[model samples]
Target chain A: GIQVEQSPPDLILQEGANSTLRCNFSDSVNNLQWFHQNPWGQLINLFYIPSGTKQNGRLSATTVATERYSLLYISSSQTTDSGVYFCAVASVYGGATNKLIFGTGTLLAVQP
Target chain B: EAGVTQFPSHSVIEKGQTVTLRCDPISGHDNLYWYRRVMGKEIKFLLHFVKESKQDESGMPNNRFLAERTGGTYSTLKVQPAELEDSGVYFCASSQDRVGYSYEQYFGPGTRLTVT
Candidate 1:
């Protein structure tokens, strides 16, 4: 089984600030996704970057497959950004199903 | 297009009681999955369903958990005589493809279960 670890287990930031979260995997992965779990317990899909880089609004993510790590950047964060961000990956050896293995997550808080 | 949807936003039951959760994936999605986070732990895969067939269920905690996807539509997860350890948020996700080559999963609002 592959291990996924996320850094900065907890963070607090003022509104309009910027932040970066990192995820490190122990093995190569065929699938990787970043999610934001809002206070309402809704898991919102942020990005699906198995490799390379992509941006969506104020959020962006980059994954270095060779290094087995991913980075998520949040710029000009707003108070609504307060939530838990998760990075989940499915190892290349996971076979057909490729069920996701989730990280502990980074709890982000943005205050006004 | 509608995203994945789950039934019973929250459930509270006593230990040893039976409970069933339902998930309806997005239309046209062939891959449906179930995962859960227990006691503030990381979310773990419970199973995967490719249409009406069970692709994998290795993540199921024990025999008390049973999942079924009939007619290649909605899926149901039944827990017979649930235990306190089962208290957590259960999430259902669906993807348009087999989960590789850029196919991403869309999650439903989780169902929070509290077993007393």
Candidate 2:
């Protein structure tokens, strides 16, 4: 079983601030995704980056697969961005089975 | 386009009771998954279905939990004789493909199941 660890178990930022969330995996992965669990518990897909960089609105993510880690960046954060962010990885051995090993999660709180 | 949808946003049952949670994936999506987040724990994978076939069910906890995808459309997860430890938030997600191109998994709001 692969292990996924998220940094800064809890984070607090003021509105309009910027922050970075990090995820480290124990082994190489063929699939990695960033998800935001909204206040209502809807897991919103933020990015699917096994490697390289991708940007979506105010949110962006970069995964250094070789290094076995990923970083999620939120710019001009807003109160609505407050929620738990999770990084899930799919092992290459398991390949396309669709089973995702999720990190504990980074709990972000953006205060207005 | 419609996203993944789940029924009975919440459920409460006593130990030994049976409960079925349903999930309706996006119309054209071919992959559906069931995940659970127990209290104060990270989300854990339960199973995956490619169309009506169970592609991977390695994450299933035990025989008490059964999942089904009927006609390659909607899916259901039944927890029979639910135990106290079975209480958690169940999330259903669906992606567009099985291989290549990392597709985003659209998730449902989730069904909060409380077993007393």
Candidate 3:
């Protein structure tokens, strides 16, 4: 089993502020994703980066697979971004299976 | 275009009662998954279904939890004689099968279950 640890267990930021959250995994993974559990408990997929960097609107993520860690950056944050951000990983052993072990999650509160 | 969808956004039942949760994945998706998150705990994997076949169910806690995907379109998870510990948020997710590795899983809003 792989272990996932997210840093900054809790974060508070003002609107328009920028923050970077980190996720560290114990072993190499073939599937690494960043998810935002909104106020309604809706798990929204933010990024699916196993390697390299990707940007989507105000959110971007970079995964250094070799280092077994990933970073998620949010710029010009808004109140709507307030919620829990989670990082989940699945090892290659699962192959096409779908069991992602989630981290403890980073609770973010973006005050408006 | 639609993402994964689960039925009965919330459920409340007495102990020893039976409860079933439903999940409708995106059209054409071959992979479906079931996960749970108890109070003050991170989300834990329950099982995975690859188009009607059980891929891996090692995460299932016990035999009381039965999951089925008939016809490979929609899936259902049945908890027979549910107990207090079964109370939690059950999440349903789906993803497409890629060449080497799997893709990102699209999750539903999740069903909040409460047992008395």
- Candidate closest to the true structure, highest lDDT: 1
Ordered from best to worst TM-score, the candidate numbers read: 1, 3, 2
Decide which is better by DockQ, 1 or 3: 1
* Candidate 3 error regions (>4 Å): A95-98, B98-102
Candidate 1 Cα deviation (angstroms), residue B73: 0.8
On residues A15-91, what C-alpha lDDT tens digit does candidate 3 reach at each position? 99999999999987888999998877778889999999999999999999999999999999999999999999998
- For every candidate, the chain B TM-score is 0.95, 0.95, 0.96
Residues B1-116 of candidate 1 have per-residue lDDT tens digits of 88899999999999999999999999999899999999989999999999999999999999999999999899999999999999999999998773343658889999999999
* Tens digit per residue, CA lDDT, model 3, B1-116: 99899998999999999999999999988899999988858999999999999998998999999999999999999999899999989999998875764578889999999999
Local accuracy of candidate 1 as per-residue lDDT tens digits, A4-87 = 999999999999999999999999998899999999888999999999999999999999999999999999999999999999
Clashing pairs in 1: none
What are the per-residue Cα lDDT tens digits for candidate 2 across A1-112? Answer: 8899999899999999999999999888877999999887778888889899999999999999989999999999999999999999988877667578999999999999
Off by over 4 Å in 1: B98-101
- The most accurate candidate by DockQ is 1
| Cα TM-score per model | 0.96, 0.93, 0.95
Candidate 3 displacement at residue B45 in angstroms = 0.5
Where's the lowest-lDDT run of ten residues in candidate 2 chain A?
Answer: A90-99
CAPRI accuracy category, model 2: medium
TM-score of chain A of each: 0.99, 0.96, 0.95
Candidate 3 chain B weakest ten by summed lDDT? B96-105
Estimate the TM-score for candidate 1: 0.96
